[model samples]
Every structure is written in C-alpha cells, then in structure tokens.
Target: MTRKFTGLLLLLCFACSLRLAAQAPVQTLLWKKQLQARLDSLQRANGFPGATFAAVLPGGEVITIATGIADSVTMSPMRPGHRMLSGSNGKTLFVASALLLAEQGLFNLDDSIELYIGRESWFTRIPNAHSLTMRMLLNHTSGIEEYLEQGDFMQQLKGHPGHTWKPTELLAYIYDRPPLFEAGKGFSYADANYILFSYIVEKISGQQMYDLIRRDVIKRYGLKATEPSTKQTYKGLAVGYARKGGPFPVAGAMVHKNKLILNPQFEWAGGGFVSNTADLAAWAKAYYEFKAISPALRVQMREGVAANTGKNHLYGLGMQIRPGGEAGMSYGHSGWFPGYLTDAAYFPDLDVALAIQFNTDNFRLLKRAPEAYLLDMARILATQVNNH
Candidate 1:
C-alpha cells in the first residue's frame, strides 16, 4: 500500500475508535467484580431474600445488577428486570403528576384542598381540612395524621386482612383523628396527604388517579416497566420478607411474610405502584432529570422546608433531600412497605441517578433503616463510575 493511503486509513480508524469510546460503557468490572462482590456480601449480611440495584450514567446509559433470590422458598434468582413493590417511592410519581398538572395551569398548589373535597362526608370532620392547601399535602404540612399509624385502623386491617378499603374508607381513620398542629404550622410525613391529593386529581381530571398518571406521565415518557398497580398484581413480582433474628439485626437468620397489608386502593396516590431497577433508572432520567417538567419547576418542586427548623433532613414535594447523600448533596425518596423496600436518588452534581429495591424489610421490626443501605448502594455506583 502507498504510504499516503495507509496514513489516511489510520486516521479514519482513529476517528472511529473515538466514536466508539463516546458510546455508553458496556458491562464492566464495576458490575461483575466490584458491584456484584459488594452487593452479594451486603445482601447476605443483611438477610435480604433478593435485591436489585440500578444506576443511570450522565449520558443516559443504565446498569442493573441483582443479588440473592427472588423467592426464598423456590430459590428463584432475582433478575435485572424483576418487578418489586415501589413502597413510598411511589410518592415521586404522585407528586410529579400534581406538579405537571400545576405546570399546565390545570390546578394550583396553593389552592385549598377543600376546594375539591370539602363537600365530601369524610373531610367534614377532618380538622383544618377546609384550610389545607395542595402544597401542604405535597409537603406533609397539612397536619393530617397518617392512616397507617392508627392502632384502631391497623387492627381493622389485621382483623379483615382480605377486605379492601376504598379511599374514603381510608379517610375514616384520618377524619376522626386530631390534627397534629394547626394547618401549615409544622412538618410531618403522612400518606394521608397524598391519598387526599389523589382525590383532588380525580375530581378535577375526571379520571381515576391511576389513569391520569398512566396516560400523562409514565406513558408520555416511555417508561414501559413502571406502572401503577392499585389492586392489580403484576406477574413475576419478587417476594418480600421480614428479617428475623435473635437480637443482632442479622438479615436472614429467619424470615416472616411481611405481606403488604395496606390494600392497594387505600395506598392510593401514596405507595401503590410497582417497578423494576432498569425502569426506575430510566424513569429517574426521564422524570426527574427533565423528561417531564421544566427546569424552573424542578427547582420549585425541590425547594424543601423552611430553614428555621434546623433539621438535617429535608422533604421536598415527593422527594427527600439528604444533606450528605453523595459527594455533593442529592434528592430522592426511599420506600418501605411490609415485604418490599425501594429507594432511588438523583445527584445533580454528579449527574447520576440510582434506583434500588430489596425484597426483605426489617425496618419496623429490627429498627434498621432501609434507606441507609440503599444509599450505600448508590455511593458504590458513584464511586465506581467516577474511578472508571
């Protein structure tokens, strides 16, 4: 070959190689060696029946890895795409739906929730119901107690485990309870806030909350695996377990079925959704990273509570701000229900997002904070990516 021709061919090959390097990093040692190694130890150490974790790169590529078993009884391995209950992470969707509607001028966050549900019998007895604004509900400042914490209501749930309660029925537990404080006077996390917000969405949108979210948000964005599962079970869901042990907080010395008790309908607008690691990683980019709302509104949605409280933790509309969640700070929510633990976080500084779900939960029984574990998982992803 002529020297000139050879030089030209070499230049072309170099350019092609550069282009390939720019593409998403394929599966790496991060997944097989580091992540799997660490996650396997963590899962076994924590006693999780199965768990899944995912990370979204700055350029929108995703990596999902799983450990342990999906069903402890059957020993089925957890896969990258296996669906798990979303727990409180569903708050992200409910809040985002409300914000999107507000952005479109369909509603206003400052509007009184009573504007929609005041006439309903359930709200008549709820203290401060007429004075509560949609913003209060989103931020958990509405003074409404969470329905799940009521001993009487929980007894009913336990007594009739097979019965499903409608949204109004869930309200029965909240309506009679005394307000924790005057409207907007305090910060509290309450599922009742979102459940009631779902009512407002249905009233104004003239569709079920599930339909509105499905059509407007999840569908518009191409999240095929993420779906609201109120009362409808998805196939291949991972089995959840409650960790049992003597006193050391070991994960799987024994496990009990911490079956999800809050009927899906009652969980409404709060935590009744299902998703997998891959979809959640994509959803983080699509929904939280700009697929849905405007950048200005994203800032507004995450403004968090007043600074006077001096609290380390901050709660945004649907997200939580972990002051020390990453190399810089981050925003996301962690989800916990009986059998499932789900968590996802987005780091604006790193431009990376991570989602993780575990089939075992001992938060209530073992006093273990599931979010901390999930956050560690995110840190590992960030550490590996940054090193690579």
Candidate 2:
C-alpha cells in the first residue's frame, strides 16, 4: 500500500480506539448501578429468611449484595459473605478434581468405576455398578437409584439427626433396587451417582473428596469463604428454613421456618459443600472463563448430554446447559437442600456471571417461592446484558 493510504488507515484506527476508550467508563458505571438496583429490588420483593446475590463483570469487577434475616432467633442480619449450604453444587468441584486426576494420567474418563470401587458386596450392592464408568457418574447417566428419594430416607435422618453416614451405609438403601435404566441408556439426576464419584476419586487419588475440593478448587480459585459442607457448623453460617408441609429432616420440627441442617456424611461429594454468594459468583467467573481448567477438559465439560427433559436443557459432565438462547447459552447449576436453594450461571455472549442464594426451599407448598425464581433472575440478567 502507498504511504498516504497507510497513514489514513492509522488515523482511522486511532479514532476508533479513542471512541471505545471514552465509552468504557460510562458503560462500567452504568452497569454497576443497574446491577445493584436490580439486586436490591429482588431482596425487597422476595420473602425468605436470608438472601444474597453476587455478580462479576467481564472486566473482573465483583459485587455482592444481601438482604433479610440470617438468624430468626438472634435477629442477625444476613451479609454477602455469610456461608450457606451449597448442596449439589459441590458436585462440580469433585468433577473438577476427577478431571485433574485424568490429566495427570491417574485415571481415564471412560474407565469402568468397578475398576475402582467395586460394590462392597459384603456391605452394599449395586446391580449395575460393574457397567458404570467414571463419565457416567459425572454426567448422571449411571442408572444408580437416588438414595435421597427413598421412602424412609428422611425418617432415618430424623431418627438419627447427627448420624454421619459411611458411603456404604448410604448405598445400603439402594442396594436391593433394580437399576433405573441400563448404564448410559438414559439420564436421571441421582445423588447416588455423585456419592459414588466421591468414592471413585478417593479410591484412585487416595484423598477424600473434601480434601480434593480444598486443594483443586477452593484454594486454587481463592474461594476464601467456600468449604466442604461436611459439618453442621460454620462461624458465619445462617439459619435455614423449609416451607410448610415440606419434608425437613430435623427432629421434632414443624414445617415453615422450622430449622434444617444437612448431615454432611451422607451428602459426601454429591451436594456436600457450603459457600457464600460471593464465592459462587467467583466460581461462575473463574470456572467458565477457563482460569484453571485445561482446554481439553473444558471441551468435555462443554459437550452436553441431552437431559430427560429435552434438548433445550442438557446436562454435561458437571454442569447444566440451556442450549437455546437468543445471543448466548446458559451453563451452570442450581442446588436445593432442605433449607437452602442456590443458582449460579454465566452468559458468555454477555460476558457476565451471577449467583443468587436463598436460605429456604419452598417447593410444592407454594408457587410464590418456587426454585425457578433464580432462573427467572438469570433470564432478567441475561436480557439486560445482551440488549446493549
């Protein structure tokens, strides 16, 4: 190109750069205020014991906000940093550990889990355990019966509120049941699948699921407030409540504002962790942004297995995906335990991530406080981000 033509091109590029630089500050301030207002409005409108929400912008700015009572008895207010039960969301942490092990040549995703934790036949049995693979467990395609759904599971928990369960003990309930489907024939969300994952990782890594999460996910990502929910107590933990007629496992407790605490033993790797909204939001940003995950493993995590619901919603190795969206897709998970319900997601097209936690599960009894509330929040956030 001629010198005169090159000089004009440079001037055009400089002008475009100046325009974008000038608009950046205005966009940042506008988004900060808008996101805060939206969260504040949600807190005011939603009725719950405690609520917290956190979000991260593409530029790495983090914001967390909270509202409502942390302790009804103590009348303590909730804070953004207060930790609460993560429930099944902890599955992702263990999945990451397993993936790390896979990278180190410790195990293969396609390896049969029976090669690791064969049924403790003297203790418990799984009819289809021999055919299940590490990938099946990670993707919830193992056909394992959900121990949590057993008729008497809550009764046993109520009878022994503080009983810490051995993995075998938890499996005992499902031992005699037939497989729900042939291994990988279908998908069902089963806590048993992840519980077995904890065993699978431990058997090979020689480390407990909690320790693996601490080393691979929490400490690695600087999730200061995140922790394995293998215990009932935390310094800044909040009280959890259940809706009226809800099945809460607390002994001699009435539904609706009745306190519920998770027995961490049975929870194991399935839903056995706790964290604040801030930590969860950080997770959305870090995990999806490929901070510590390898590109190959990231591909495995991204590929979806069609869920029983439909192709619109898919379940991947450790994450949930809604493949249909106008400008982007949603990938993350929602968690529900006795007293806590949480949802966190990231929208790649919009370059935003968010997490919302409510310290109560109001399913069945009321449509007003359904678990889908967080999903609605996600739609709202995504729309706003994508519009401009």
Candidate 3:
C-alpha cells in the first residue's frame, strides 16, 4: 500500500508541474498576439508607417514587437534593431548621466547656473540669461526662450541643412527675449533648458555631452542601439512619417522624404540621440532598477518639482511626473520631434517598464490615442510573467 501511494503522489506532482509549464508559454503568446493586434490597429487608423514596442518585467523577461516598415519607400519592414530619433526622450538619458555625476558629488542639484557656468554676463548679450540655474534648466523652469519657436530658426534650418550650431549661438538667437516666466516660477516646455544643461554636463564632466552619455549611461546599461545623433545620418535612420493629409505623415511619406536623414547637431545633447524600442526598454529597466545610478538619487530623480498650477505636469530633474491614483504612480518621459513620438513609463510597484515609439510627427494623432496604452500593455505583460 505504501509503494502504491508513493507512485500515485509522484504522478500527481508531475501532472501539476506539466500543467503549470503548459500554461506559461500560452499566456506569453496570448499577450504578444494582443499587442501585435493593437499595433496593427493603430498603424492603420493613424497612417503611421511603422511602430516599435518593448517591455521588460521585474524578473528580466523581455518582449519586443515591431510592426510596419522601417522605411516605407524601400518597403523595408521594421526590425527590432533599427534606430529612430528619440527627440525630447533623449533628455531622460541626459538626466540619468547627470544623476550619476551627482552621485559622485561633482555638483549639488540646487547650485545656481552662475556658480557652474559663470554669471549672466557670460550670456550678457542675452537678456535674463543669468537668472537661469542648473535645476531650472533641467526642469524647464528657465526663462530662456526656445530657439525653435523663432521664425528665422526654422527657415535657417531648412536653408542651412549642414549648419553646425554652437550652444552660445543657439542661445544668442533667443537672447534678450523675455522668459516664459521668471526663473523657477513656472513650468514651460522649452528646449532651451536642455540646450543649456548640455553645456553644463560638458563643463562639469570634462567630457563632451555625447561621449559622456555614451560612456556613463548607454554603455553602462549595456544598451546596444543607443547612439549619439552625430554618428549617423537621419535619412538612413528609421523613417518618421505622418498621414497623407493628416497632421503627421504616414510611414510611407517619411521614407519618401528621407525625413530621418538630417544633422541634429543643433539639438545635440538636448534631443539628438537615436535608439530603438529594445534599447529604450533596457534603459528604463536599468534606470528604475538602480543599476545606472544610486537608489537614493533615483528617488530624487523621480520626485516631483513645484511648477505652475495650471500646468500640473510638474518637472523633475530630467523627467516629467504626473500624479496617479491612490496606490502608486508611474514615471517616465515623452518625446516629440518632426517625425517621431516616443514615451516610456515604469511602475515601481509592478516592477515593469514599457517603451513605445511611432514613426510619425503628428501630435493630433497622439492626442487621439490614449497614453494609457503603454501602461496597459506593461500591466498585461507583467501579470502574465508573474502568473507564470
């Protein structure tokens, strides 16, 4: 009787294990299918030629999804490895590097701009330039006007495609202009802050901003696809598109115009990095896992900074923080450029991070799509991995 009982127990245990094993891959496959379906729907509806997505679970399980074409003109299908412009999303990388320096005690976060980069006289030709600080620059609270909004700036860009821009020259274009508000008084989305912050990164690190980012952040995290914009031509990079008559071009148009090919020197260190979904996912994982920076500093980076009441989307060191429900919150940054839109988010409680990018420039389409899709996909993927 004892022998018979032992055999039956072993059989039962084996069956249970088999059942669990069978269920695991099925769940993963189902999530992947659903994600693919969602991507397809978005592409058809929004006229985007291509989109890429990646997610990482706390346990380190990874899934990457690519749909549509990398270049619609070439009819090249989007690949997992193709690089795309990150635009403002690049700021997150800069912020991460800054935190690493802060961890080393290079500079205090609250230090004034005058302390590190000299006084307003340095930008004496530009009005109110001295009131800016390192913190304000990081948080977009600096009063410095944005160069991109200047009427002549865009014209100059189109006319002088190969023009190499100096940081001071870019700032000079907006010099003497009134700030969006007094320094540290309000939050306004200005690229000027990052342009200045890039200079500070160079001044403090004694390394060019691009090289510093590559060494301190990208290589440190083992990111394979992240590279400085200076290294590649935008035309050869992953194409960005908008709808035919819509706000953004369709993926096909992006490939046709070679919008991806351009020199991003003017925006270097501010919004010039290029990467793909997979690398971005890995970056968020390293960042939130505290592998890239100290845990203490990570907390500070995620913390919210005070800003305009109407613009409650307060800025952090190098990120934007939006308050969530009672349980916890999400953290990440969003980027938009001529032909690309990207956003990434990490849920601390869930231990999951998701990165999504579309090869389109249309803000209107983005407004139509729920930002929650990224979070929703992350949640679905995380739940599946956990259950397994």
Candidate 4:
C-alpha cells in the first residue's frame, strides 16, 4: 500500500472515532439543558417553588436534576435524594407485590375478595359488595368509592388530629357509598381499591403492609430512600408545597396543615409512599427488567384492561400503559398528592426509563408540563443512545 493511501485511511478512522465520542455527551448535555429550561419556565409561569427530575436509560445511564427549592419557607434546595410523597403511584408497588405473591401460589388474580376477607355482615350491608374481587381491586374495577371524596372526612380527621386509623376503620368510611358502576364494568380511579388490596396483602402474607413492601419490593431493588409516609417531617426531608391557594390543608385544619404536608398513615398503601428520584429510577428499571416480579406477571402488569369504555387508559396489574405513536410506546405510572407530583416511565423498545418528581401542588401546570417535556427529553436521549 502507498504511504499516502495508508495515511488517508488512518485519518478517516481517527475522525470517525472522535465524531462518535463527541456526539453522545453533546446530545446528553443538550437534553439536560432543555429539561432545565422547561422546568424553569414552568416554575416561573405557575409560581411554583421548584421541581426535581431523575431518569435512567436501559443501558443503566442516569441523569438527575433538581431545580427550585423544596420549601419556600426554609429556602431548602430540591435535591435528587429528597423524599416526596408518591400518592397513587404507590398502587404500582402494591400491584407488583400482589403479583409476586400470586407467583408464589398464595392466590390467584381472579380470586374473589370474599374468599380472603370473607363476606362479613358489615361488608354485605354495603351495596355491590358481592362483585368485588382481588383483580377488580387491583385493576380499579371493584366499583368501590374513593375515601377522599367522603363528606368532610378530612374535616373530621382534622378535628381529631391525633387519631390513628386502622385499615378496616378507614375502609368502613367508604364501604357504604354507592358504586360508581357495576363491578368489572368501568374504570373510575378509587383509593378504596388499593386500601383493600393492602389489607389483602396483610391477610394473605400475614405481614404488615410496610414490612411486606420493604422485604418483597424495596429491599430487593436496593432502594435506599423509599419508605411509607410517616405523616410527620423527618430530618433531611423535602418540604411539600401547595399551589398559592389550593384546597389542600382544606379550611380549619391544624398540625402540619398548609405546607408541604402528608398524612402518611391515613393514606397507607393507596397513596402514602415517599421516595426520591434516584430510588424511583432504580425501581422502574428493576420493575421493567422483571427483577421485582416474574416475567409472566410482568407481562400481566403491562397488559391493558377493558374496565372502562374504549379500553380504559391501558392499565395493567399496576403500571399505566402509554401507547406508542411514531416514537414508540412506554409504560409506568405517575403520581400526585397535596404537595408533590411524580412520573416514572420505561420505554421497552428503547430500553430506557425516566422518573421526575416536583415538590409543588401546582397540579394544573404539573399535569400538563412535565410529561410533555420529559417525553421529548427521552426521545433525544434515545437518539443519543442509538447513535452510539
């Protein structure tokens, strides 16, 4: 070979390697900057204290960003590890736990709630109780009413601030309410379903809800910062914030009212877990990889039910399904509570997952903004991953 030809070939190889190396970090940085810009814009537009987000690619790459204060009062900055209430997102965890138990042959998905909890005279007194089942509860097809909508339940609790509720007592509050529709006929989101599921976990596993989740789910994934809400502030925790004038804290409440607050005990299992973005990302990866549950159960978790009209929102055992368009589809659940909002999604085709948590009650803005921005960011990240 001629020296000049050899030199040209070597130059081509060097340029190619440099080009490849430069592309990924450049794209990653650009994606990060874009997410930061969106977060800033949302905070400014909505007057929220701040927001935090964390994401992990299928290949195990991760990015975490905390923009804004966790609490306007103390001027604490939001950090990746700052724990926030996961609200209904806890349902995903419960569902996974239920499936894990099912895989162990403890119970079947189609088993009627009556088989476990039994048809007590008190339960039968409630309308439509006969149709309730474990699957119905997990899939939100049980026709149970949400406890949060009970007349002045919050007011009653605020009046008795020191009272701690047993799961049965909390269940009693909603058991008498009229069903939204026939069991297995519709998908009306209800906390009562998960509250019952938590009880079932205790009944079957003979273990408390917190202990089961810690041993079966959180510990298995090595999730260091995840815990059931204590309804009291802990050291090194992020303070929750409501929108400037939101219904949270309601009127005439005391003791941890009107601030970034959570009643972890009351909302146990249904919506009272607290976790940071990093732990969330790790959990999502573990969930999608079938490390938390069996592969068959994982498939069941991602399958959509036809509880509501038009096939519902593609809900599986615990996770929410986002159907793909041109960008392909993703699956996972999002959460909201008095002072926090979170989203964690995994794209199967791309093998990537992203989680975001904002410690603000600006649900109006949060509902619309973060999902759109994060999905766009995911696309960009996927491009970077594929190019390399």
Off by over 4 Å in 3: 1-23, 119-121, 125-127, 231-236, 242-261, 306-312, 323-328, 364-372, 382-388
Off by over 4 Å in 1: 1-32, 243-263, 306-311, 364-368
Where model 2 places Cα greater than 4 Å from the true spot, the runs are 1-29, 43-46, 122-124, 251-262, 291-293, 309-311, 323-327, 364-388
lDDT of 1: 0.72
- Candidate 4 residue pairs in backbone clash: 58-351, 240-260
Which residue window of length 10 is worst by lDDT in model 4? 251-260
Winner on TM-score between 1 and 2 is: 1
State the lDDT of candidate 2 residue by residue for 1-388, as single tens digits.
9999999999999999999778766776665566557656665665556688787766676767777877777788988887778777777777777787788889988998777776456323674877888899888887888887776888888788768888867767778688888998988888888877777678788888778778888898899988776556676777776665565554221122433454555787777777888888778666676546578889888788888644578898888886435536867777877777887777787677778887777643224432254455555656755665
Candidate 4, residue 91: how far the Cα is off, in Å: 1.5
Which scores higher on lDDT, 3 or 4? 4
lDDT of 4 by residue, 129-213 (tens): 7777788788787777888767777776657654667888778878668887898888877777888878877888897767777
Model 4, C-alpha of 261: deviation from truth (Å): 5.2
Spell out the clash pairs found in candidate 1: 46-251, 47-251, 47-252
For candidate 4, what's the RMSD? 4.4
The CA lDDT at 225 in model 2 is 87
RMSD of each: 4.6, 4.2, 4.3, 4.4
Q: Write the per-residue lDDT of candidate 1 for residues 1-388, one digit (tens) a residue.
A: 9999999999999999987676435534344456677778887676657788887777666777898888777788999888887878888877777777888888888888777877786667875877899888888888888887765775676566557677777767786678888998898788888888887887887867777778776887677788776653466678766455422222341222534333444566778788887777666655556546778788877778752222477777887877545546667887876567887877777677778888867654323565565566656666766765
